[model samples]
Target chain A: MLELGPIFRALLRNKIGAILIAVQIAFTMAIIVNAVFIIYDRSQQTKRPSGIDEANTFYINSSGFGDDFDIKGTITRDLEAIRALPGVIDAVQINAIPISGSGWSMGLQTEAGAEHDGQGVAVYMVDEHGIKALDLELLAGENFAKSDIRWRGPAGSKWPAKVIVTEAMAKRLFPELSYSEAVGKTVYINNDEPMIITGIIDKLQAPWVGWDNLDNAMLSPEKMEFQSTRYLIRTVPGMRDQLMKTVEELLAENKSRVIDGMRSIDYVRERSYRGNTAMIKILTTVIVTLTVVTSLGIVGLASFSVNRRKKQIGIRRALGATKASILRYFMVENFLISASGVVLGAALTIALNMLLVSALSIPPLDWFYIPAGMLVLCLVGQAAVFGPAKKATEIAPATATRTV
Target chain B: MLTMTNVKKVFRTDLVETHALRDFNLQVDEGEFVAVTGPSGSGKTTFLNIAGMLETFNEGTYQLDGEDVSHLNDNQRSKLRNEKIGFIFQSYNLIPDLSLFDNVDVPLRYRGFDAKERKKRIEESLDIVGLANRMKHLPSQLSGGQQQRVAIARALAGNPRFLLADEPTGNLDSAMAQSVMELLKEINKKGTTIVMVTHDPQLATQATRNIFVKDGQVSEINDVVAMHVANG
Candidate 1:
């Protein structure tokens, strides 16, 4: 039989130790729940796909230094050499690599005026081979033909007449139309320069992983005539590392240019999300440490309670309480304390989560974490109290008759 | 009814094995009030503990109400003790945190009685001890004599057939002692078998039978009060 009423009243009379342990449990639950949620959120962020072929792809930069570096002719020759390699799938000279933390952005509007609001998008300058080199699926329209490619000088201001967009950017630009229907639609960049949506790709991420519109991007068919150029290359399976070394050595052979910033997509992704990984590790440590401290607090309180009530326990045993009953008594007593702690902890968890949402701009926590935390903390309390309660059962009933 | 034959209890340590009881024997019929008196280190408490099943004897054949309890497990012994025996300690042994009603309800809870039945028995027992009106008062709020009465009420609430008391009035003044003695006598008159262990010879004379314990053995005596007076 459970002695809940008697145990509660007893706790009320002696509230100091019980209250301290309860508060410890409450604080521990609050911190642990929120910390676990944060860790999970960070892990999910790190696990999200960047919508690129990260495993078999890499990128390198070529910054020509001499006066007559032949930027356009050199880019053409470099593309031909890379594509003609044995294991090379495709290659393109792009203005920026996706998820590489450096890129260009522009806003587009359906209406041709500054008075209308526009959606933001990351811009990638590439030639006809952009989709194939980046391993993208042309979901809604045909890929760019070679005749559509154009060349612009360093200070050129002319805009391309046609552009291809990711499905995410297409949806944002034309929410009322399906992505396939939006393929031939016209949108204006730079407030009035009209650009037609020539095609739509299935998925692609922005260069900045932390952007709210991470998947909003567009590919413009243009070759750059500048002092530096970046080349994106995709190799067949198990050929990327050998190709990366070969390409770096080949680019370095030309004395007019320096080969630097040669990195794989995997390395780029890791460097991009390093902060989130560190946060997850730190929060996991915090959760574990807090749970251990709270469990120890429960054990300390229960052990002291048992030592103080040795005589009472003996009296209960003499009054015909079995060892099981004595064990039940203490266990049930600790349960009551744990129940109170979890109740208070629920409120504290929500309050802390609210503060985090407002201060850190994180999304609101899912509702189930509160109850899950409560159940876990209660189990911890019960397990921690078991050893002391068992020791209490070993007290002899003859202790009741002993004067000292 | 209770009987013990050649009961042997020894306390052992690393270097010593002291005999607390050796070849002790006793018998008490139904409806008898027996007082056991002895000096310090005489094993009176040890014998009472064994009879109450609070301690197991090393070698003995004991029977309580026709059941051989020598080989009972701890759980079985607890059940038998709950169903058959009640104990009153010298210190009253009331859980100080609980009210009089809750203290009285403890033993009945172990007996697995329903709440309504337990309530009825607790009220009736406390009324017998004249503490029913103060059932909600904590034990610390009561006097030593009143606390002992609560202990007696706790014992009686379970409706056991046998009662074992160790120095029931040891902490009381003479007036309170006499009052408790009269209460014990009244309980005995109602056909409850009781065995009381005490150092007070005057109190022992109040029982229908007196047995003196010396050096772990017993001898029946009829004039304990006179013997105590003569020794003084």
Candidate 2:
């Protein structure tokens, strides 16, 4: 502790250089820590919007010539062939898939002759097996069956406005209605007569890294009469890709419906979040590089400053300073300067984070960056001190006797 | 005790090689006060530096307190110098920003002594130099004589084997120089070997013995060395 006074005094003797080094440290830390925070935010959001049971699901898009323009039967035949493939998992053909390239938007009103005040939620006209293939749970009603098509109108029928809604959308449609109350109530979509809200399915969270994902409402194909360009498939473990290929070939062989290439639900979800994830990667790289450079600069400048004090170090040596002691003296001085810089940087990162929030759609600060910034600074100080402190220790006491 | 026999130091540059000491020899036992004097570039400073283990000679064995320091590393030399040598320079070399007490405390801190022990030694040594009450003063605040005294206090705090001074009184006025000389004589009487190098013939006369070097070689001249000391 007694040794600290002189080391500290020596560092303080050059206040400008010390403060500048600290500033460099702080600046790099701000970028580095925030970059980490941004990556964490990306991960959370990527996993946030997923809805499908990613492990069990795959999506097949069929887009080509159908028999004299009958895309639905063409789609249905391909779906059947895919289901029959080896490692056969249950599969279904649906008119509309969630987050599909095509979806219809219309007003959904909950009472008779209502003026269609609110727009309808995304509605997938699916079969019983499709819901099961998706692992969707019915919150207040039974799952769809192939038999339900007899009770409902044609696919894409101007239904009396009833469709499933997410738990969140249900709350929005009826402020006081509980999830149970929203069920069995008649809602009008596109100002047509009201359709009953059959069942609410849970919202989906997509994966961070693809294209086969849906996160909204599903309805019986009997209610919505219009068919869609999407086909959803579920295959047994490891067979989904092969089955997808077979389905495409079948669609081509039948000449009734066109078959699109195969992709898992994982692919769609990954695609959904790729933009943000890539951004995070780029930003983190930039911040890390900046931090490393800043730390190196601090170390280099500190070494130079300590070198300039060689004669003083020599005087101290002749005054009975052990070489190790002198080495420590220089090292401690560098650490002190670095610590001050880190503190300043932490404060600045907070301030800069506020500015970033307003300027762009950036994620919030993450937890990992704080320690990473400090570690970078420490390594910088230790590395830089090697040169200057070694030079400092090598100063011969004989220098003190000579005329400087 | 300090002893050197056949001490040879050669300085070499890329273009020129110069031998500063050619077969030099000197010996001083415990409590001996010896002064080294010579004309400009006479190797007085080099010999004194070698004696203090601050510099090593090229081709001779120099012993300080019965140890051969010829092959020791820098750290080893630093430790030996710290534990056994006191240095007083013409410039005083007090860290201007520090208080007298802190200056005295500097070397002791490097010795790895505890705070209490270092403080006690600093106080005692400051008192011995009659600067106990002024320990709080800065070197810049003190007169030249007082600053040199603080430098001595700092050196003495190490309890060194000997004091190697390069023109200890060179920067002082006549009275201040006399006072510093008296302090050195008193310090020598207390059993610390003192080897002083000086250009001042008058001040050089106060040592118990004097050695004159001409052209990197020492020659003992009994009558001439005495006359030089006696005239002052």
Candidate 3:
């Protein structure tokens, strides 16, 4: 242990410089802790299974141009052609793709005329082959039968009588019941239309990646033919590129409609969470830049201090202090400053995390990150001061005899 | 005891090489108080620095307390200095931030003494300096004479075998310089060997013997009273 009393007294003589360094370290600690938390959260989100065969699947968007074009007929023919193509396993027309950040949502309640708005649930509209195309597992109950499929066109609008809800959605609606018990139960949509739950999927995320309720989703057996129709086509492994080109050409050959877009589900998911990925990148850059700048700041300050105290160092050397003692003096001085900054940073980290939790709805930062951040700062502080401390130890004791 | 034979020190630069000390020889028995006097640039300070082991001589054999120091590395030299030699500077080069007690405690701390031993040495040294009541005062808060006495106390704290003082009273007035010289004489009476370098003739006369240097070589050595009568 060093003599901290003298070290602190020395720092008090240059309180401004020492305080500035401490404050810099505090802010650096705050940013690094929160950035790590956010980065970990976003990367975990990207790693989640989308309940769809994202690697080998692609989607094509088609919109009818003229009134004479038969929209329903074109969708039916397009899906059939896509399914029959080489390397194509299964194809289904969906109202919206999973993890696309764009989908339809409705409120579901256990009873009609309930005063509350009920739980918001993501709604996916597909046919009998939807589960197979998305590779979703049926954990309980049964898949939708072919006869139960309903076609809803522009001429008429009606809700599906049967729906397949994810296990998360089932728990939200009927928390007290088992997954099997949730099946065959009636849930009212818009507090009017009654639909029976036919199946329960193990897991299916919502379109929005960071939503608190991403797993609350349901699938309706309804054939939707909108102005712009979307077809999810799953192909054999390593055949997405070939299948996308073939399907795009096949749809282009028909002049009745225009191909708005065609991309693999992997690309779609990347685009949907582009904001989240960008945030991660930006936070990482800021963290790296802050660490560098803070370290450089410490280096600059220590170098300046060494230059200013050269005579004092010479005197100490003349008084029989070894080179290692002088070196440790400066290092201990820097550690005290860094340790002070870390304490201040812990409080600042809590304050900043509270703001983030309230404004962005992110979870509170984990407790372990604080000590982890402090360790990093301590190491950085010591490394930064080493160069200047070494310089101080080289001062010859003969310097004390000189007038200067 | 201290001994040096044919000591040489050179200061080198890009354009010139200056011989600060050449063929310097000196020997002082234990408990002897010797004063070195010289004109400016005559290398009296260089001699004192070498004697204190603060600087290395390029060519010489030096022995302090029966140990050869000519081949010791920096760490060994520092340990020897801490244990056996004390240094006093013209400017009273006490660390300004530390109190008088802490300033005196520096060499004792370097000696690896425990806290109780260090405290005992510090208090005893301070008491010997006649400023025992001012232990908590910083160097900046004291007069030049007081600061120089504190430096002396610091040198005495380690109970060194010898003390090397480079113009210890150069910055003080006549009264202060006389008091400091008297203190040195008292310390020497207690059997601590002391070597002081100074230009003040009156103060130089107080030591047991005086050596005069000219052009990096010792010109003459004489007893203080005999030199006074010879100059007359």
**Which parts of model 3 have CA positions greater than 4 angstroms off?**
A155-157, B225-232
lDDT (10s digit) by residue, model 1, range A1-404: 89888889988989888888888888899999999898888888888887778999999999998788899899999999999998999999998888889999999889999998888999999888999899899998888889888997999977899999999999999899999999889999999899999999988888998898989999998999988889999999999999999998888888889986889999999999998888888898888888888888888888999999999998888899999999999899889889899999999999999999999977888999999999999999999999999999999988888998
Q: Which residue pairs collide in model 1, if any? A: none
- The DockQ value obtained for model 3 is 0.66
What tens digits encode model 2's per-residue C-alpha lDDT throughout A1-404? 43677667656656888888888888877876776677777676576644656655666655554335654455556566766777656766655444334454455555546544764456556666655666666677656555555323243344523356666556657779887788887766656566677777776321212222233354644422223355676667777767666766765675544445456767765666668779888987897688667756766786687667666676887776777877887778888888888878878887777777778656556645666667776667677767777777878877777667
Encode model 2's per-residue lDDT on B1-232: one tens digit a residue: 7878899999999999888898998888788788888898998888888887777779988888999888988778878888999999888988765778888988888787898898899999999999999987778889999999999999899899899998999989999999999999999989899989988767766787878888888876334346755875
Quantify how close model 1 is to the true structure by its C-alpha RMSD in Å.
2.4
Q: Pick the candidate with the highest DockQ.
A: 1
lDDT of 1 at A332: 94
Tens digits of per-residue lDDT, candidate 3, B73-116, equal 99998889989988889999998878898889888877889889
RMSD of 3: 2.1
Q: Write candidate 1's Cα lDDT for B1-232 as tens digits.
A: 8999999999999999989998889998898888999998999999999998989999979999998899999999888888899898999999988989999999999999999999999999999999999999999999999999999999998988978999999999999999999999899899899999999988998987899998888866554446557766
Q: How well does each candidate superpose onto the true structure, as a TM-score?
A: 0.96, 0.78, 0.95
> A154-200 in candidate 3: lDDT tens per residue?
67656888989999999999999998799999988887678899899
Candidate 2 deviant stretches above 4 angstroms: A44-68, A85-125, A131-143, A149-203, A206-224, A235-246, A252-270, A353-376, B10-18, B57-59, B67-76, B96-99, B123-147, B170-179, B214-216, B221-232
